[model samples]
Target: MNTIEVKNLNFYYGNFQALKDIGIAFQEKIITALIGPSGCGKSTLLRCLNRMNDLIEGVKISGEVDFKDKNIYSKNIDVVELRRHVGMVFQRPNPFPLSVFDNVVYGLKVHGVTQAFRLEEIVERSLKATGLWDEMKDKLNSIATELPLEQQQRLCMARLVAIEPEVILMDEPCSALDPIATAKIEELMFELKKKYTIVIVTHNMQQAARVSDCCGFMLLGELIEFGTTSKIFTSPDNQKTQDYITGRFG
Candidate 1:
């Protein structure tokens, strides 16, 4: 079933339109990769899903974003809860200055989960799910930022899972990691899709090929083509998609 559906979506930052009549649906518990050149509205659209763009000045969104059959942009929708349901992992690892355990449990606390036992359970489960528990379990009270960038990124993922979100949005998550680290994260994404639908914005074609079930090509604020990853890379219907996949200018 489709977990997220966008219809005729439009976005603008100041006078410049960043997304134009974009529409797509993300199936539940699957990986959808957004591929495009820089400034192609991939990240902008991703941010819109969780209303992260609302934080930027002069940002405006129009049309519908249906998440699990509910319009997330409706006036009555709780923005905080919407974000909690659709968690995000940024390109950079952004662990808080506090202890690793505290960072993982931050979202639950923010949403009024006050029980220490429950918080510990969530942190343990989340860290174990993200494959960070064995390494960090003993060091839960240590500053998380002190970890390497790759571990920090996994920690960020663990933090997102701690909130028990329905969808996980990643914006160029491997952009800052080394090749080995990137491979590990890609493998982790395959494992994660069993529980959470994933939307990832990636500049690396190989990474998308490796991790995505579906791929969408965007250009200059427009979604030009979307289909199964094999079809997109093997025999794209759109000329632009073909060019981009063939190492021509994106």
Candidate 2:
């Protein structure tokens, strides 16, 4: 039931090591939250899964990220294809300036899906999957950025879903939303796990506790502890994890 198995993962930004000897396995069809304080390498590790780090300059990585039995770092691997299967949603709601319909089908369009009927069906399906269809169906041609924050974030997620990704990586997905919007996103995260393996890097401890099936506690650049959400929150095996969860110190 493991979707991703990362072994001895090490990453460097220039000469500074951002991740050190990290090893972890993410379960399939569940939400795994990586929680830590700011600048703790949680986001760096999340980006490594789908090779987003490749876009950064002066970066080096050494590890085996076996995703669906294929080494993601293999020389012949196609990053675009890899990213198509492993989608990402950023901290902020970054909808394209295009219409809601365009935003939803943008991925499909980029991948050469141009049939009008198929595109329309995908837009409806993806939007409905993310709970945006009912609200935005009438305003399909409206500008994406003009929507509310919650709808915008959901639209971003709907866009990802349109491509039928197997895994979704979210970096502080609810950070920019208000309380109500955050709650809606959290609910959406819960629903998404049934179909896609979700990995989320979140600073919000309560949100992590509520949405994730499993949790990993990171410190500095290492995974201090990882286990079921109940166990991690109630009785962590490591003192660092306990201290972090108890608010003694992050």
Candidate 3:
């Protein structure tokens, strides 16, 4: 059931250690929420799964992050292929300045898929999967930025789905949206877990409680506790986790 595993992981942004000896295994096709205060390596650890930290200058990572039995950090590993298996969605809705149709199909195009009918099928399915198809079905060729911000975020999800990744990583995905938009996205997150193993970082404790089956709490670059959401919120083994969940301290 462990689809992704990390062991003895350590990461540094030029000697400033961001994560320290972090290890956890994610169950397949379930929602796992990573929660903690800001700058606790929640997002940094999320990025490490798929090697996004490689983009930062002077960054060095030392870890064994295995996805489907392969060490993602191995020298023979292909980052592009690794990313294709593990897709990430950012905090903001960053749809490119192109038609909605193009935005979703862009990934397919990059991988040398150019058949018009097949591309259209993927675009429709991706949009539908994110619940954007009914709304944007009639305006496929219109500029993507013209849509409401909520729809735009869903479009970003559609863009991620177009590639058919096995895992989806969301970093504070609903932080920028209003409560209503956030609720919709939360619902979408619930729906998405049936198909993909989702790892989400959230500032909203309630959101994490509602959506995630399992939860991990991190602090000061260390994993404090990880368990079922019910146990983590109600009766955590770690004092830090209890304090955090109760709002006594963060």
Measured against the true structure, the TM-scores of the candidates, in listed sequence, are: 0.98, 0.98, 0.98
lDDT of model 1 at position 28: 95
By the TM-score metric, which is better: model 1 or model 2? 2
lDDT of 1 at 151: 92
Give candidate 3's TM-score.
Answer: 0.98
lDDT of 1 by residue, 17-77 (tens): 9999999999999999999999999999999999999899988889999999999999999
Q: Candidate 3: deviation at residue 201, Å?
A: 0.5
Residues 78-154 of candidate 3 have per-residue lDDT tens digits of 99989988999999888999999999998888888999999999998999899998989999999998888889899
Q: Give me the overall lDDT of model 1.
A: 0.94
Off by over 4 Å in 1: none
Candidate 2 error regions (>4 Å): none
Clashes of each: 0, 0, 0
Model 1 steric clash pairs: none
